[model samples]
Target chain A: MGMCPEHYIDYMHDYLDGDITREHEQELKKHMQSCVSCQKHMHELSDTVAFVKSATHIMAPPHFEANVMGRLPKRKNVLGIQKWLRRHPIIVAAAVFFLLMGATLMASYPNDNQFSVTTQPNLVVDGQTVIVPKGEVVKGDVVVKNGNLIIEGEVDGNVTVINGSYMASTAVVSGQIEEINETFDWLWYKIKKLANDAMALFE
Target chain B: MDALVNKRIKQVLKGDQNAYADIVNLYQHKLYQICYRMLGNKQEAEDIAQEAFIRAYINLHSYDQKRKFSTWIYRIATNLCIDRIRKKKPDYYLDAEVAGTDGLDMYSQIAADEQLPEEAVEQMELQDRIQYEISRLPDKYRSVIVLKYIEELSLQEISEILDMPLGTVKTRIHRGREALRKQLNNL
Candidate 1:
């Protein structure tokens, strides 16, 4: 005897939420006139709504504005390095990553076009081409700049060619053979080394 | 007033730090009320309200000037309040008795100083009970109820403040009212 039609219950809630259509509201009112259960339910819902609305609003404490003003972080330099860094974390990350990557390119930047090479004890130098003879043993690292390196014998250390090419013919080298042809090649060499080192460490 | 608020925002952007004081004053009471209703403790309400204002000032440049500043500030305040409610350990105390109100209750603290009429006092005690019930609601429903009824915001506004769909907001409001209605019926 006290149950409301399911749709009528929905109507009651929709009315209280201020979302009921005019037609539904009229229908609900008419239904409520002959339905004690719906009337009681509507009264209960409205009472709770009114009760919350009637809650006593408190005043903000005195000096609230002063407190908020005081707490504003020292904005002397609003976009100070540290604050800007904190706000744009992704940009900061990308900036940092690229900066470190650019460091390799900076080191490889050609300051001059000088043809230079570290002499080997048993090496033959022909203009811009440095060659280790067929049976000679180089004592230390061989670096050729603005030139080419031709190794046909044993070199006990690394062979780094800068702004040039290298051809190893029956060469026995104890270290890495790095060919840095240009700025970009140097950057790629350093990046590849870094990535390999990182992977090794993680593994 | 919106024009004035936008002006203050511009001045603050131009290194006028004191211009933010106007914003703080204009919204302090309204924000404090929402904080108070979300968290029934006077001390926490004041602290969160102050924090919201500080955060807003720090991120003032990110605020879209096209929209009402009130909504932006309210969103910040409500988010802070909801975070606080979630951080608190789930309190399952089912008591709504005015006598069972805790020591940190704002109403009990000020009830002594208010020499209100008999009817007013009774009404206040009732409000205290309602506040207790509101605090006991789950965080999801509690925010919707407080924003809708206590803050008297429209459904659209509540949706924006809570960053939920309007349909989700409506569903939460309905469920929250049912919960409150059941509590009143039991009482």
Candidate 2:
């Protein structure tokens, strides 16, 4: 039985699997009789295969699947949204900021156009000025300078007028409507007051 | 097709998060086995296996779709185990003398008994010894041998997983197993 090293090596796996052809098997058997080194190598290969094949499989732990599953993101619907947002963090952040701003503005001023303020008498107020209609009250010492103040009823607060003007009705001025129509501080204050009230509602 | 798996994985990378679970289910068991063999403890193996999967999931975009997904995951798990083994200096605590005498005796007794063929039993015992010897191998050889023999990956697969040329993978497997055989013969 004559065998080349290459053929024997090629057949080594088949020999171990017990699937060698008859002629090659005879050839290998005869070669192994005198080829001590090749025989030892063959034995080693067979032993290695046997050893590996005999390895006891340690089954993964009880929560093996669960542990891996837990590592996976929870199967919530929002994870998809989160993943999408994570992929585009910049865009999502911008969108969320604008969305929150719009919601805040809408909540802060439910109605867009009109604002009203009540006045008190006897104190010299600094800035209370708006375009008041024909019949409105000026109860305190009020001054109107800059803004258009529509003073329809009695002014209970001390009105100090500045740059803006106030169209006030003929009513009682206890102190003075001091400053008006100067900087539109009256309208700014009313808008600011509405914002503060909205914030208070949130709390 | 493997492309289908890669496509699913691409979906996972592209913000289809649920698609990740499918990839996990496909490879977790095989990864667990590798971790178990390398780490040799159930709890640690489980943790390492899960972490390996999660890491792979997070870095899935970096994986080349042309390669087998199994090979990719195996590489990650093996590298992690090797890193842990190195960081912990497994050799110091992994002294053969520290292994339980009872377990070794019981295994030897089984080998010496009549339940199986003498050759088969000796092979089994040698296999256990080989596994122990693997832990004693230097990191580079250790990884290649484990991936080739114990994990039963093809040479191409091992090379791909290791990101090495085929020649290097084959040489490492040969030398690693030879080292194990030498250690076993002495034992």
Candidate 3:
């Protein structure tokens, strides 16, 4: 019985690799003795391997070492803080998160004893008195906490005075006048101010 | 030699910046040859080889001492070459022609008494044919063949460099050789 072409090719590789057993080797030799096609296939595979093996080794061009060395990245000092930060990314991220959190808290924190005041050209602050001068137009709202609001001019918007009194002389007040002396009103004002400051911080 | 290279690596880690030039000199030719054979373009090979060295230097601290330095460097170079091959469109014939012509001119000068001039010419032609055929193989097979025959690396080394199983590398080599044989037969 002769070996089939598939078996012949399989044995051919084993034979070339010296991996065939003695019995298989003898059987393959017997098949090869009569099979011209298997012999040709074997030679072609062997020649292919040999041709690749004999391919010339190409040397790098002149100054190749110099070129590579010049192109090499400069060694960075790992002891630097930037390197340390790179190695500990989680710590860096956590530090940044905490810093932002602290800033937001500071900006949003309510101060029970501090008050802010804004004055237009018509509204003036003189030592302890906030005065809206006569013959001047106040275009926006006027709010005063813990002090007296004196409007002697054209107040075109609302006037709110908290824990304080309001005095007007010929004032053209277009909006309502509010005087807040209750504790609930003070707490509400503080909450609104804190919210406004927080929004400004984000913007 | 590995011990010496390891010593240099340690020196580099210890702030000896110039010590890396020695490592570059040690493997430049081998790395360049592998890239040249794989890409079939001299300029690309040089550029890729230089990039490999730069990458290796940047990542030197991550090198595992258990493996050979040559294996680590070769792995970096081979990976870069494979990425470049995948990213770019195939320009097989253009590179083959340029490299083939250069190979013929270079080999003609060294093809003295060992073989007749006519046989040398035939050998050069065969070399060009093999290179062209190698460029046409699938990326996986081409990588194994170039590392195997051109670099003469052991199968185990190739497996390590490729991060592939030994059996898989063997199969690729077998398939690559078969493909080359079919091409040769066709010619």
Candidate 4:
């Protein structure tokens, strides 16, 4: 359980960590030849160190970046967010960004609907038609998919639609209104969303 | 390189979220490896690694410009790992999969050297046993052992990462290695 000559323990460890000087190493080698206990201790400790150093170098999982970026929390301030705003191509092309989001459908319906709309609490829903009925003041984020989004009322938050038409007859919006009909717009939407978010810092 | 990393940190602090991505990409593997060795679970390691980066991002204002960003981030991750290890009951995550099916193994090493299959499997088992023993180490000893042998970091760098005196680091490494040898002896 212990080195026979207790100080030899330091010699063994320094030797194992390769932190020993040539002089000390020679002394350690010379001592180990005649000292069975220290020799056995050194051998066992070397095995442990070697075994540890042999561990495999594990890489981050395949979706590491997406997981980090997708989970990057949103900030309420724009200037606090814009420095990263244009990092798109100057940063990343965000090509994969659009592709991964292709599966997010209606938050409430959970893919039951063809439209990938976010959940916008309060409003009107009739079959595939969703409406911010005129005069009705809807709060928080809203998304529409599969069916058309008719905005005749006032929305206090952002409105976004995916794979569906958006008709704003008399809609008064306080935030960004994003309508995505193509994957290309997804890229544009990303930038515009940042810009829109960036603008909030100034306001 | 550190100057560039600091600049990127400044950029991120100024409102560029994308700038942080570069930092994440650069250190993800290293941090992930540290977390994996420390926590012994791929899922928990990934979560802690990501948490470290996000925490750094949110607290960029407090980062000391004079410090090496790697050291700073490593400290953050090391602290997170210590917190995680100390919070859990002993051996709670012991069976959370110590084998790195995704990466290297000693069997492969022995096979590469053209050793016999029986010897390779035996060595592989020994290696696996060593990893599990490391994961089972007390938080203090495990930290020093992982930083020294697993990461091959300098004793000084490990001191900076763990924020302890150099002598304490050496003592822990000695004790940690001793503990590992004892555990492996039972095999």
Best by TM-score: 1
- Among residues 3 or more apart in sequence or in different chains, the pairs in candidate 3 whose N, CA or C atoms overlap within 3 Å are none
Minimal lDDT window, size 10, model 3 chain A: A108-117
Question: What is the docking quality class of candidate 4?
Answer: acceptable
User: Between prediction 3 and prediction 4, which has the larger DockQ?
Assistant: 3
lDDT tens digits by residue: candidate 2, B1-187: 4876887888887677777767776676778878866765567778788889888876776788876888888889988887876675533433233356743433342211113343543666544554555555677887776676677777788888888998787667666666665655553
Supply the TM-score for candidate 4. Answer: 0.58
Tens digit per residue, CA lDDT, model 3, A120-156: 7656887657888877888888877667888887888
Question: lDDT by residue for model 2 over A1-203, one digit each (tens)?
Answer: 13456677546545653557998888888988888877887787767656655676556666666666666754465755766787898999899986776566546432323333334342233344343333455443444333345455566545654444455556444544544332244445445657878999999
Report, for every candidate in turn, its global Cα lDDT versus the true structure.
0.82, 0.63, 0.77, 0.78
Ranking by TM-score: 1, 3, 4, 2
lDDT of 1 at A13: 79
B78: Cα error in model 3, Å:
1.5
lDDT (0-100) at residue B7 of candidate 4? Answer: 86
What is the C-alpha lDDT profile of model 4 across B1-187, one tens digit per residue?
A: 8888988988887778899888888889999989988887788899999999888877787899998899999999999988887775553343344376655444342212122344444566655655566776777899899888878899999999999998889889999999888866755
TM-score of chain B only, all predictions? 0.81, 0.72, 0.80, 0.79
Per-candidate TM equals 0.62, 0.52, 0.60, 0.58
Per-residue CA lDDT of model 1 for A1-203, tens digit only, reads 24666888778778888789999999988998998877888899999888778788778999888888888888766365666787799998999889976975677577699999996668899998999999888988888889998999889987889899999868999988899886787677668867989999999
- iRMSD, per candidate, in listed order: 1.0, 3.5, 1.4, 1.3
Which candidate do you rate higher for TM-score, 3 or 4?
Answer: 3
Rank the candidate models, highest lDDT first: 1, 4, 3, 2
Q: Could you give candidate 4's per-residue lDDT for residues A1-203 as a string of tens digits?
A: 35366777888888776788899888888988988888778889988888788887889998887788778877657634554555555444465554455433222223344644556666778777788886788888887766788889999888888778888867899988887766566656666666878999899
Q: What is the Å distance of residue A85 in model 3 from its true position?
A: 6.4
